[model samples]
Target: MHYVDLDKIELKDIPKISDPDGRGNLSVVERDFLPFTIKRVYYLYDVPSSSTRGGHAHKELQQFLIALSGSFDVVLDNGKSRRTITLNKPDKGLLIPNGVWRELEDFSSGAVCLSLVSEEYNEDDYIREYEEFMLFKSS
Candidate 1:
């Protein structure tokens, strides 16, 4: 892994259009919405609040994470500095670049985490161990 600046992680408020029925808001993410073209999309739901997810770093994956339903907190580490970001609005998302370690925790009930990735699933691209991640960053 290479050194990633913590300042590069950003929370973006996607444009939301209200429903004609005055019911709810809708946000769209086309290719123009992100720096990279999205190739994979996934979501996490029905998670216990005490459970934590995402304790790894990717070699070449960029992702945009959204709170589609409730809320959660994302803790980011770049092997030098750390930061915590809260995602509660459906129209907002966090843009995470490659080489940064991310952990998701403190999920509210009925919370849904939607992730849009720049690449397809590749297990070899992920560094699942913290020590290995640290070594990669130092190299």
Candidate 2:
């Protein structure tokens, strides 16, 4: 395992195009907004307010999380440091690099989380335990 700096985490504002008729806004995410090509896209919705999600770290996958409807808090940890970020706007996202541990919590009612990933789903690439994540980070 190698040491990954906590500074690599970042919040980016995605561009939104508004309709002229005052109907709604459109947000776009392209290759320019991310560090790598997006290979998968998914969303989490209808989560209960008391529930939490994402208690794991990826070995090589990079992800960008966006709040499409309501709001939620994302807690990121790199073994040595930790940071919490709130996402509330559809036009904004949080970038989580590889090897970082993430937890989603404090989801407001009707909150929707959209994720853009650099790779497809692979169970072997995920580190699901905190103790194992710490060991992986230190090695």
Candidate 3:
């Protein structure tokens, strides 16, 4: 597998519009803000505190994840390196590129994980096993 720089994976800001006179805040994710055109949108919510999600990697799929309600931890691995990122801000998002392993854990109560996907659902694109991911990286 070609080496991927873990440092390049960082949170991106979603454009925000502030409301005057103490009302509320609004954030927008425009078409030009993201590198990939979104083809699917989904969200995870009402999760148990001890439960975890996403223990797989994608071959050609890329995703942008956001914590729209509470917070969670995303553990990312790229064969030779690993890192953990905390998603706690609604206006910030994390982009997971293809060929990287990811796991979501440590979800706070009422946490919501919203995903903007680059492709439609396809079972063949996922690498569900860690061993298989390692092998795919080497090839």
Candidate 4:
């Protein structure tokens, strides 16, 4: 259960280009620029500004989270301690290792968060309850 900080992350910038269509202009993230050997890629959109997400902890997957738009606070807890990180830059991401409990809080309006995972979705890999997380960690 460890919090991989910015100093430890090997960041690879996701490419973006302008596209002005009949509607409006937009930027897209290129596939190659997303260098991770991803097994699962998911995005969290329309997250309520007053609510928080992600209360569970993973057992074997490593995830890199990026705030693609707007900003949010990532609260990380490694069995012993916790820290809150504000992610606002697209080029930056938080690399979270297995066993840590994470919570995404203080989401700004219209925030889009991208999560790149090392493994595909598996129900057994997740520890969804805080009490269970503490017990499992202790054992």
TM-score of each: 0.95, 0.93, 0.98, 0.77
Clashing pairs in 3: 1-137
Error of 2 at 75 (Å): 0.4
lDDT of 4 at 51: 88
49, model 4: CA deviation in Å? 0.9
Over 1-139, each residue of candidate 3 has an lDDT whose tens digit, in order, gives: 6867889999999998889977889999989988899999999999887998999999999999999999999999999989999999999999999999999999999999999999999999999999999999999
Tens-digit lDDT string for candidate 1 (1-139) = 4677888777898999999999987788876999999999999999999999999999999989999999999999999899999999999999999999999999999999999999999999999999999998998
Query: What's model 2's lDDT at 137?
Result: 87
> Pairs clashing in candidate 4?
none
Q: How would you encode candidate 4's per-residue C-alpha lDDT over 1-139 as one tens digit per residue?
A: 3343533434444444445565633444445544356788999989998889999999888888888899999888766678888888776777777888889999999899999898999999999999999887887
List runs of model 4 lying over 4 Å from the truth.
Answer: 1-36
Model 4 lDDT, residue 25, Cα: 39
- Candidate 1 stretches greater than 4 Å from native: none
lDDT for each of the candidates?
0.93, 0.92, 0.95, 0.79
Global fold similarity of model 4 (TM-score): 0.77
Better of 2 and 4 by lDDT: 2
Pick the lDDT winner: 3
Quote model 1's TM-score. 0.95
Clashes per candidate, residues 3 or more apart or on different chains: 0, 1, 1, 0
What's model 2's lDDT at 45? Answer: 96
